[model samples]
Every structure is written in structure tokens, then in C-alpha cells.
Target: MTTRDTVHELLRRIGESDPEGVAELFAEQSDWRFSWPDEGHPSVPWIRPRASRADVAEHFGALGAHHAPERNRTTVTRILVDGDDAVVLGTIAQTVKINDVSYTSPFALHLTVEGGLITRYHIYEDSLTVARALSGDTGPDRRVP
Candidate 1:
């Protein structure tokens, strides 16, 4: 498949929350880097330089455990592809219940795929917003944690 086709398929699979399909798009020993800036949340800076298939599985599974993937709607705004690289800009509206309080966070992801596999994933969102949501803070969501 062409690079654009591959990336489009991969992004579609992810938005569909089909972990199995997403995993199938990656190489067995592909190097994956996912970064979530110091959002003050424990899950921040989750860098995986060389994430294997097992690691990918665990990552998606953990996401499902934390907040049902089906509940987080992924809407793609744009996707640009060139050769073996591509960038996907999308938004995720998630409803997460933390400490009995429901937290809804809107976030964006910029993904880069190489050799028909995802190589990097960078998150763009309001850090304080995420921190407050994760910590169940209600004070104007000012502090990071």
C-alpha cells in the first residue's frame, strides 16, 4: 500500500478503537515514541523509543482500562502524508470518571507513521486541564496538580 493509504487506514483503525487492527499495522519490532508533555498527570512523558508489538498491546489495553476507548470519540480534522511519513491531526473527546467525578477532556494527537507503522505520537492539549481532570481538582483548573 502507498504511504498515504497505509496512514489513512491506520488512523481510521485507531478512531474506530480497533486495537487489533492498529497492532496489525505496525512492524513486529517497530520503534514507537509517544510523548505527552509534563501534564502533571502520572501518564505524562510516556516515551517508548522502541515499543514492540507486546508494548503496543499493553498500551492500548491500558487505555481501555483507564477509560473505555469506545467512549472517547476520535475525530480527525486533517491528515498529511509524504513518503513513509505522515501527520494526523485529530481530537479526542473523552469522558473519564475519576474519584466518582466525571471528567471530560478534549485533546489532540499528532501521529507520525513510518514504513507503514506508527513511529511517533505527540499529544497537544492544555496540561493544566488534564492535570486537574486527572486529579479531580475543581478550583478553576489552575494548578497542574
Candidate 2:
């Protein structure tokens, strides 16, 4: 498969709750990094880290364990590929459980694929919205319920 195709498929596996497949889509020595816009909110800040394959596995595993009640719905907005590298821009909509409350965060993903596998992935989302929803404080415009 083309690099773009491979990357999107890997992400699709994550959305589908197929962590095994997601792991298989990466090269054994792949350098994977996931980042998000970090501003404030120390308690629940955006995530950004470079990880090994095992580290990535643990990362997603923790998320799955935490957000067990929420099913992810991801949609690809754009995909860019150059040689062995590719980037995917997409939205992730999901309801997460926090203190028995369900919260949704509309988010985006910036992925880098290399050697027909994912190398790096960054996240972009409405952090304020996520914080408000998680805190049960109702966002400015978007109501949390």
C-alpha cells in the first residue's frame, strides 16, 4: 500500500478499537510521537511524546482502558504524502467517561508515516472545550451534558 493509505489504515484501526492491528501497522523500530497543543491546565494538559513501539502500545492501551465506555468515531479530512512520509488531518469525536460523566472532544490528528508505517502522530483539539466538559463546568458556547 502507499504510505498515505498505510497511515490512514493504521489510524482507522485505532478508531475501530483494534489495538493489535494498530500495532501491527508500525515498523518494529518505528519512531512514533504523538503531540497536542499544550497551553495550560496542568491537571489535564494536551499529550505530546515520542515513544517506542511498546510505549505506543501502552499509550493506546491506557486510553482504551480509561475510555472504555466511549466509542471513537474518526473521519479523515485530508491526507498528504511525500516519498515515505505522509500526514493525515482528521477529526476524532468520542464520548469519554470522567467521574461518571460523558464528555466529547472534537479533535484532529497530524500523522507522519514512514517505511509504510506510522512514525509520528500529533493531536489538535479544543482543549478548553475538553476541560470544561471534563470539569462539568459547561463550556462558553458548547454545552456539556
How does each model score on TM-score?
Answer: 0.69, 0.68
Per-model C-alpha lDDT, please? 0.58, 0.60
Tens digits of per-residue lDDT for model 1, 1-145: 7767877787677667676777787777665543444233574222233367666666665555555555665567777766666666655555444443334444555555666666655556555555555556756635332
Superposed Cα deviation of residue 62, candidate 2 (Å): 1.7
Per-residue C-alpha lDDT of model 2 across residues 37-72, encoded as one tens digit per residue: 434444343244536676566666656654643555
Give me the candidate number with maximum lDDT: 2
Supply candidate 1's per-residue lDDT for 120.
58
